[model samples]
Target chain A: MSGGTTTRVDARGGSLFAGSASVRALVYVALAALLFGFGAIAPTHLASEFVLRIGAGGLLLGMLALSVAFLMSQAGLVVLGAASVYGGVGYLFAIAMSKWDLSPTAALLFAFCTVIAYAAVLGALIVRTNPLAFMMLTLAAGEMISHSVMLEGLRDYTSGADGLVVTFKGAVFGMTAADFANATQFWPIAWSAAWILGFAAFAVRRSRFGAILRAIQENEERMRFSGFGTYLPRLAAFVFVNAIADVCGLLHVLNSGFVSPESLGLSVSTNALVAALVGGVANSTGPIAGGVLFAFAQDQFGAHGFTQLLTGLAVVVFIVLLPRGVIGGLIEGARRRSVLSSKRRRTA
Target chain B: MRAHGVIALLIANSLALASLLIMLSSGLALIYGLRDVINFGHGALYMLGAYLGYSIALIGGFWTALVVSPLLLALLGIAFEYLVLRPLRGRSHIEVALVTLGLGIILGQALIFVYGGEARGVDAPPALAGSVRMFGLSYPLYRIFLIAMGLGSCTALALWLRFSTSGLYVRAVSQDPSVARMMGVNADRLSLLVTSLSAAFAGVAGVLAGPYLSVDPGMDVTMIVNCLIIVVIGGTGSIAGAIIAALLFGFVQVAGSVFLPDLAALAPYVLLFVVLLIAPRGIGRGRAPA
Candidate 1:
């Protein structure tokens, strides 16, 4: 009788995530390749440097959103503090280079690993809670990181909100700091990173581990009863998404050659979330597209000094009207049209 | 100053901060209990109240602002219930929360546009502005009034929840919505009441915060994050737990500022993590997780 009741409860437990991620992996790869190709070549062809720079920023934001969307889709958890890992990685890199006099390459490696560890430690604690609590904790944790960076004690190291300008002492991944900072040069790099991160997210979503994650998210108790360790999968997913955010953050700092408290602010994380919402959370391309779209919208609104106002409006509109996000909505529309045409042909 | 004097001041300060926090977090907890939705815009509402209070106080006095802000917010609370909350009732809680967050951003931006991002100061009425001596230590009277208001509200909240039919319904819905619905409890009506009451409390907290914390565009975000941390630490829907957590948060924040000075801003977060480490489910006697 108890077993029967448990299964029944499990059936209705994941109503929030009943329909998602049905597309095959091959499709994801093909779409990613197409996007990467366009992103890589389009910047070179376009004459406007301003647009390319904005596009690069969008790709970076998209990369961050990809991480956010993955966790949201797979784990039924929203991360409100992704900016910490993203911005924190940059701060560590700059600090390592400046304070410890480490080579840029070494600092890059050190910062990446450290942020991964930070994510692991943070994820271990936060993933134990329910989804809402998880969301709340992420936001708090993000704020904690932001505050620490501005600590008066760390003023010499972090510069106390004046921000740290990082000049690479040695070649990082065989590219000079100047190369990374150039708008035209940075565009392809950001585009490539977005594709790599997008594929990483896709691979995780397709793997057997991904299946377990979805199962756990859908009905954690059922998965646990069936002998799966639900905790580790979630913790792993948390780290995995944050690692994606970390990579984006590193790339962001690399391109900008600067890191500030603003990078780690709640607004940064919210922007990524808004991008995820605008683009759709189910697949990689959606978030990337959403990021690009948000970047452009921000640029437009920035002119009017209404960036945040539009951002807030966008969040409401997208969540209410475009629940699946722009890419998701567009895909759905195309699929519906195809189905309608097929039906007409069949009737004829 | 003597060690005892320092201790006394610490306690007084914590009580003042905790009073404001309790006023904010309790409203957040109550609404969460009733609706299973965290109003991410609670901070923006608080900001709105502070701004409104500033304007109203300029025309009348601090007393008038305190009284009028909550009444106006109660009306907005009703509108929020019928409009935002009701329309989004069928949506997922996360989605609804996101919408509230978005609305919060919009509202915050609107206030910033009007107020132009400068911090606004509201003077305490002449009666509460002066310091009073107690036990050989002088303390600000406004904070004393704040503590009194805090204690008064707590007593009122407790009494209402203990004796009233609506309050009981709220507790019932919060603890077990399905069971309460099966019993034919009108959750919608209860939610409406909770929403308005919570908004009113946020208004009160905002007005109180003006003389204490200063009114600014950024206050909404900071207060919301603090309240969110408190709510999470207290266990999402646990009202009693929220109050206790607010007290703890208040003490930690105050003590950190007084003692550490440098790492003061991060004190509440440290307190939060320690509590979460010890009790993953939170420091609350609330319902089991879904």
Candidate 2:
């Protein structure tokens, strides 16, 4: 905030409004083409089904991390129970289809609306607290959902610890269960979902509401003194992030054909958090990349049965040693170079 | 008067649970009061204490384990203050808390590695093993011991906070750190003391939990969650409020388990949300963050 004008301008942003716009646009188009080509071709190039499966899973996780990062950066509130929405949407989807006997598309819409309502109600109750209390409440709420799933009374609905197998025949978003479950077929779906969610988060972060949210986060008292409501914007932000997680969770259920208590557990939420930290909470891409990075790391670490240990270590190391995150750090370094080069050009 | 006996049993059960919770939550509340950072590794410290107690009890007796565990934990507490807390003093409270959460996960996983995934049980020393007739009802003697310890610690904590110079300093700092520091209070020195003391209490609670709750890999998460709920409900940094919240949480939990077994696990969470709704800042006189 105290930085000089040039320093404060965010050189790395190099937004579309800047000079040499056509060149940047060409670069972006080329990048998009490259990404689209990768999404189409990577499944075939990767020989092993295991790698493709993990890759798809990584995209889903990255989307979840994007939501987590969005909340953390914009609202200055860390949600420790993102899995509730992520897994809750899946559970609601399964329950809606199996119990209500709704059609696949109806169930998908029903599940999405129901979970958003849940997020609204939950967010309304929680978004008024200090950040620390807010974080703890989210954790408690996540555990509550996980525990609720295991209750004998809810067993018939949730399938207790065994979880529910959700297999839908008709396409909700034009992809059947079989299509989603197949590794190669699922890759593009996951990739597209990641891109959409990432873009949505980025757009929201750049919105006027995003400015208000950041301002409230910076100083709630001052915002209040300035006659801002302070509560509704935060509540909206909470529901927004949860909506992102809801979409990610739906995709996960579609891909896996399974919704279990474990998915709603604290571990999954922390995993998303760890992914966000590793990728950097500053931007949308960092979290998605982080999700993929952590997923692959977990895959390796799982072989040694040190996944949990590594998760703990990663949280500490990322926050302490690399607070900007791997991607955030890279962006910072790039921005610094650009600024320095611009300084030299001006002098010359 | 069987109904009376049943009520007595329920209260006793809740008190036993609250006893351990009081020890754990107070430690958490104390640290939050002084440093303004919740020790997310607190549950891990308790778990470490329990695991260490399990081994020590095997070598000596439960008595020896109780004496030695807190002493060992005090050293770890000192190390934590010097090694982790002091170094990260400049970071945001949330960041520090996240670091502790990470440290906790590492510690918990390491313990799991050493002990494997299985739960370990420790005998309650022959003296407190059997049930005793209390108020015409047969009650487990170990529970009575636990309740006694809970009351003992509460009194000790109250007296210390009320009478001692350090206690006065702790209260002043907790109420307003900036003002306390301006008055020339050595906050770092005080933080070291409080951190170690909190760790020692957590150790003591862990050692006691072995015979009561059974030492398991999952216990740390459960206890930590419970402590977090209590601290939040009590109003984040208020020690007085935390004690009351622990008691309330324990009663709700115990009663739920007895009457609503199906939803017993979620009772505390229900209590938490309800409290949060009614008093978002919590039931205590916790100062808002500046």
Candidate 3:
């Protein structure tokens, strides 16, 4: 079974997007340009403060969605409770600045250390579980964190339900705290973060490690029989994706200038999952694109009080009717058309 | 007598929580048993039932709501099984799980749209409104009724599963659908029956829980997660296991609330983690034989 499984995965991989490296490069370059283009144009042409703010949120969500997409696509794990990691980092940042009175750089460093450590410990325990167990465990973990944040004992640190208004003492890489507060100023940083993380995921996807990860996803049992210690790669992917989500959490807190328990709620986690699925979890680009669209949709419907309706409909329709998500559906359609045209050429 | 009273009060509270947990988790366990579908939307169904109960109780009365809500929810459950769950017959468990998750969100949001965001509550029926003397202490009559109802329904369900023909079909389907079908059983019908029955169970629980707990849109997610935890700890697809774990956790939660208020919300989750560590297959595996 292991041998046959490995060959099947290899065959599928080569036949799909990997057949043409040049095409892949062109796709990567185009994605990078589009990401940068959005950041560049949003501050000037778009210019609406509300639009910029929503875009910033979308970009942050995009980062979170990319992390989710990475795990779902590469590891076959549907993490239902990512809010623990996301909100955990947000609280960490808020506490660092407000309670501990740490500078931005020191606080950023602290957040990094804590996030990696948290992911390492949680991922080590979680990566060993089956898919269902993984979902339940993550959900439990997220709930536990959310509960703890609201506890009276942690009120001084977490600010309870009122949330903590972060007072940035100094500049972070030439951008003042006020600059970070402004959505337009923060848009560039958010885009840069998404681009770097998105490309990193794309690069990893194209690398040999990506194939190995996919194989692990396809059949962990087979991969194990093949003498590959599958645990470390799985754990690595979990931690990496978690780290990306943690960054997203941090950016969200920094941009909003406040952090609250809502950041870690089940809704937040579910929203990220919906965004990733709709964006097409098959690739990094799809989730990022999906996050932007989702945020825009959220802003639009939220004002009119149809946010939940739209979100629910989007998730159900996308998964049931179009499982590939918007981008994935488009990609599949193009592939099918290409295949048909090639068949015609052969007949000619 | 005073110390005994405190203990009795705690026990009563625990029983109330346990009954609610049993009602919600059993449905989840049953659905998982029959189809291996996690039905993340179980919570939404529960919420919808509560809302329906509120409306019906207002228009017709508590007794009428109690009867009508489950029937209506069962119909809705059938529609759900046919419309959403039926199409993805041979898909991966995760895909089905995703669809349910989406459906749950849709249902929850639709509930909010219809019922509004404010928390709503139903009143205990006039006859059962006050306190009753139980175990040498005064306990809410409505709560005691809930406990009795939960225990009675659970017992009835257990017996039906063990002895009835339809129950046998459900058991056979869970054990192996193909084998069950080979034996001339209609697997599709059985699947629909189990799904609807499971959903009806959730609806019943929701109606019972409305007066005890808040009837609100946001309650769905939290309730679903709790039911998920209970199902996991008990081992999925095991009715007996869900019942036992629900009772155990109900006590654990009440005890935690009394002794460790700050950690009470986390007590169940922490217990789940420990159970996963010690017995990854879950404690009910051997006992339930699933």
Q: DockQ winner among the candidates?
A: 2
- Give the i-RMS of model 3 in Å: 2.8
Per-candidate Cα lDDT values, in order, are 0.90, 0.91, 0.82
DockQ scores of all models, one per candidate: 0.69, 0.85, 0.49
Docking class of 3: acceptable
List per-candidate RMSD values in Å.
Answer: 6.0, 2.4, 4.4
Candidate 3 residues lying further than 4 Å off, grouped into runs, are: A1-47, B1-4, B286-290
Chain B in candidate 2 has what TM-score?
Answer: 0.99
Best by lDDT: 2
Query: What's the lDDT of the predicted structure labeled candidate 2?
Result: 0.91
A219: Cα error in model 1, Å: 1.4
Which model scores highest in TM-score?
2
Clashing pairs in 3: none
Model 1, residue B243: C-alpha shift (Å): 0.5
Give the TM-score (vs. native) of candidate 3: 0.92
Please give the ranking of all candidate structures by lDDT, highest first, separated by commas. 2, 1, 3
